[model samples]
Target: MGSSRQCFQRFLEQKNIVTNLLGKLEENTGVYYLPTGSIAFLAFCLIFGYGASLLCNLIGFIYPAYASIKAIESPNKDDDTIWLTYWVVYSIFGLAEFFSDIFLFWFPFYYAGKCAFLLWCMLPVACNGSQILYHCPIHPIFLRQQASMDSLVTDLSGQALDTAASLTREATKAGMTHLQKNK
Candidate 1:
């Protein structure tokens, strides 16, 4: 009976220590607004309520659709180029997310996890994953391929110009010759 009482007291002390440690960590981490345990549950319910979910869905669908239409209609070359690069990266990320969802969707916090990841991607702060991806992988690979395609296009255009010039000269000579003979 004495040993049992000692063990229970030790357990309570350990629980208090852990709770205090977590509270300190949260305070230091600057996430004062972030809820934990029961508060977290309530916050989740409020944030992901039906109306909020519907609004998120609507924005998700509308933004991309609107962007696509605007991209098609816009005449600015530089903006179009920027949008093209963004869409390329976005498409690649979307494909990766599609495959990952097969497993991750089963998790209870999947939507929250996804929202956090996307926020990380969009945030302009240092060490953002999207910025890293754009600079390290997508930018380099896309630029190399684009450079090669640009060179190929330039060569083709040069060849076509030469051919057209040659044809025009030949036609002019033939016309002059015909006129001389008629005279």
Candidate 2:
């Protein structure tokens, strides 16, 4: 963990081709700013200003989607588990957000908090938000409700099939009546 943190710090500190290009552009533009200023500005917008929702959603969605795709391709079972856990956590978050979004949008720093939460849930660490929430809260509730949920799903499936069959029969009768009239 310590080594990984050190590696991350080193990565942040290193300046390469992209940094050099941005530096030259800043110099020519007669502006003095750190290479990371753009990121800071973006973060500021996400936290306090307009377009925060869009930015927060992009942060929540794009990276995990890309990571999930890569996880599908990878041979490692652990990465697959990680991505699956992320999706489960994300799904629950989405479900809760769906019901609360109208009111939540009016709250101060909501997008910022959501964005931070999304980032936490997607973090690569072992004890990331997704894993913690799943293990501590979600898994137990799922266990308790699994049987009831299965029964409800079964009932719904049967009803759906019955409805589809009735619809098909009605459509067939209509088609037959039209064909008979033409004949």
Candidate 3:
């Protein structure tokens, strides 16, 4: 039991490390994106939950579970308990989707569509949180990428210009030498 607990702790640490990397990457990129786990949770909920919710007549409950997992597993708080929670939430997504499908008219399309849309809307609000609390951390990374790309283009243009100038100089020198010889 203790070993199991230790193993769980390791899992939590791994999840947090990933979350931290994701947060850094998000900050580096301009577009605010969800962490991989949240994205996974959302996908599982939508893909799995849609069907489960319908089959089990539990769409309403499952939808909330999916949303809650994403909300609760923020970048700052990463641990084994939360990681386990994510898996539990994902399991719920599967069951919920399965149940939802059985009951709902649509098997996958409309039901999944609703959940996806709901998640899509949440991202902007997530990004808008104050920097001190929940700012879109990936914005800086994006800016840096843009700056780097721009600089790379500028360098390419400079090189092209140099090549053209060098060609022109060589052609002019050759022409002048030929004329002098002819004269």
The model with the greatest lDDT is: 2
Best by the TM-score measure = 2
Instruction: Rank the candidate models, highest TM-score first.
Output: 2, 1, 3
TM-score of 1: 0.37
Q: Where is model 3 more than 4 Å wrong at Cα?
A: 1-144
lDDT per residue for candidate 3 within 1-183, as digits (tens), equals 999568544543564434466667777875354454555665576566635335333433344455457656666554333334334444544566667755654554554665553333222232311221112333455576888889999999999999999999999999999999999
TM-score between candidate 3 and the true structure: 0.23
- Whose lDDT is higher: candidate 1's or candidate 2's? 2
The models' CA-based lDDT, in order, is 0.60, 0.85, 0.53
Q: How far is candidate 3 from the true structure (C-alpha RMSD, Å)?
A: 20.2
Local distance difference test, candidate 1? 0.60
The residue-by-residue lDDT of candidate 1 on 1-183, one tens digit each, is: 999568544543454333456557678886644324534654375356544334433433454455556767988675455445445556686788778868865676556555555445533245555567788998888788997889999999999999999999999999999999999
Q: For every model shown, what is its TM-score relative to the native structure? A: 0.37, 0.82, 0.23
lDDT of 2: 0.85
Name the better of 2 and 3 by TM-score: 2
The residue pairs in collision within model 1 are: none
Residue 110 in model 1: lDDT: 54
